[model samples]
Target: MTDRVAIVTGGSGGIGRAVSERLAADGISVLVTFSGGSQRADDVVTAITDAGGRAVAARADVAEPAEVNALLDVAEAEFGGVDVVVNTAGIMRLSPLAQLSLDDLDAMYRVNVRGTFVVSQAAVQRLRSGGALINFSSSVVKLALPTYSAYVAGKAAVDGITRILAQEVRGRDITVNAVAPGPTATPLFLDGKPTEVVEHLAAQAPLERLGEPKDIAEAVSFLAGPARWVNGQVVYVNGGIV
Candidate 1:
């Protein structure tokens, strides 16, 4: 028998790609999932397989139960069984509460909060013993940035789910946790920020630089393997930006 298998939602995105690659390097087969970026998803699969690891690309809208179920099917059929699920998939639309659109808030909830719930629900049912479920929260939940009210609200919900899910799976020996990363250099983080704003945020970290996707991946790796005692916790992967 092989080692554990993993499903990395948003595996095509910056942080997702780094995590997929990292887990694959740890000798796990991965199902790299994407909602819209098929080409990017394929690229991630290729990167993993090219490096002598096993991986497959699957498309899934985490908010849709049918699609997520199908994705889990693919992982099980291809890799034997699922042991870890890393829900790094999310969308962020920033606006101060006064001007925030309900539509944007709804979209964020669908993918961030509801999506995590949907996936975790399924993962708890199917994950083999000693499995792990990891979700993504954000440092913004603590930072309380002005324009991030909606996005941070969604992440705060994720934090809640992570804690509750950890307790819900009490006898199952499955670890549920969340990684709250500080400002990282990914497309999602850098998309709209000006260069000066980016520089300022990067300098805010005690490490005096923006975290890389690989840095966040390291945190995920720890949770997925050799960190059995660490459960029901939200790890801040930020470099002392609390």
Candidate 2:
């Protein structure tokens, strides 16, 4: 996969950054994308390049089809063609079903569901044979955690898209899969939670600890590169949280 390229949305976030660096380490050129954090994305590029890997940073709103198409243009222009597309861009606004704000719920769906759809559509059209599209879901979909109904609903859409897209891409040798991570030690998961709450969630996993970003990245690396037989499956990377 030394000559292959990837486009990773939300590439500046905790899990996104880990996946970006991990792919680079595996000899894949990465196009690191950020919606607002240009500096953070650039830092990821710098880290990759400084480590003797290849990377470039750009800004693109994953929900916008035009912007996503432009990103594909950049990847092809920069590194020939895209072989992997990772949809890590998502948002979470916790509220119960009765109390959930429509605005917040719409925001999550826009970024998590619609954003994944836009990018996946583009990837299915543009990715070369042997390519892979990895979408993001959450173990919370199964865990059905309180106050996460809206967020889980959006990810549930992602699950459906992954399964259908894999079948739709038949004979192309391209795989579509979703990674549902359980409680992990990312800012997205840790931001507003109390320490005791975090500890309790961590202990719910058989691993008895919070997941590191690298743990999820490892699963992504497999799907993106060598795991050709793995397709249309939602691999849970949450250390047995179910």
Candidate 3:
């Protein structure tokens, strides 16, 4: 992936930050997009540059087409052209179906499902030949955990988009796929949970531990570059959690 350019939405923290740094380490210039955490994004870019990698941070809301397009323009202006797009921008709100708030459901839908679609739409339209578009899904969709109805529904839509988009872009030489991670040790996963709850969830996977951001990033590294034969699949990177 050397000399390639990538735009990673939600690139300030968690899996997004890991993906940005990993891609930069592989010689891919990165446009790290953040919805709010400008400092975190800048820290990622600085770390990459200090390590002799190319990266820049930009702010854009993944759900808005104009903002997404503007960030794409930034990528083009900064690194030449977009060769890869990773839609890691998402929000999670947990609630049982009967108790779930419509407002929360709408928020998740806008940022997770609609956000992925908007970013993927732009990616398919503008990404260069041999490019790759990777979206984020949750292993919880398969696990069907309680209090996750809204989040799971949104991610299921992302899975649908990933599958259909691959076929829609046939003959374009661009790959579309989604990565489903389980029990990752990111702030998003760790926040508000009791320690025992975390431990139990971690033990549900045979690996007996929470996944690190780097673990998810490794899977992304494969799909973003050399995994040409792998398309339209929701890769489960959950250490046997399924």
Candidate 4:
């Protein structure tokens, strides 16, 4: 993959960082995009560079089509072309269906659904012939957990888009797929949950613990690299939770 250029959104945190590092390790020139955490993004780039990998950090809000396009422009200018695009930027909120507000729904959709769409659209335009688009979904779509209706719904849309996108780009060598992870041990998973609640959630998984960011990243690496036959599918990396 040394000849490839990759763009990973939300590259400052958890799964995004792992994905960026893994791709960089594989000899792909990585563009790490962050929304607000420029320091953390730079840290990731530094880590990769220190390890003898090529990478750059840029700030962009994936929800805005303009920003997404600009991010592509930067990647193209720096790396010559984009061969892989990973959309890992998303948000979540816990609320019962009755208590879920429209604002909450819109907020989640804006970042999760709309953001993935915009980023994927931009990538499709500039992606090389053998390009791959890996999008983030969630195991909650299959687990059907309560209080995650809005978040899961948004991911479901990503799943749908992934399938249709593959067909749309059928003639091209580009492949589109979604990776749905179970409860990963990220800051986002820890937020708003009590210690006991977090433990219980972890234990609920069949593997007896929550997933690691690298676990999901491994799947992403396969899809972005040698797993070209795997397209238009949602590969769940939830440690058998779903």
lDDT of 4 by residue, 115-229 (tens): 9999988888888998999999998998888899989899999999999998999789999999999889999988889999889889987789989999999999999999989
Error of 3 at 208 (Å): 0.5
TM-score of 1: 0.98
Q: lDDT scores for all predictions?
A: 0.93, 0.94, 0.93, 0.92
Ranked by TM-score, the better of candidates 2 and 4 is: 2
Per model, how many backbone clashes are there? Answer: 0, 0, 0, 0
Reference-based lDDT, residue 94, model 2: 89
Off by over 4 Å in 3: none
Cα TM-score per model: 0.98, 0.99, 0.98, 0.97
Model 2, span 1-242: residue lDDT tens: 49899999999879999999999999999999999958899899999999999999889999999999999999999999999999988888887899998999889989999999999999999999889999999899999789998999999999999999999999999999999988889999999999999999999988799999999999999999999999999999999987
Q: Would you list the clashing residue pairs of candidate 4? A: none
Better of 2 and 4 by lDDT: 2
Per-candidate alpha-carbon RMSD to the true structure:
1.0, 0.8, 0.9, 1.1
Off by over 4 Å in 2: none
Candidate 3 lDDT: 0.93
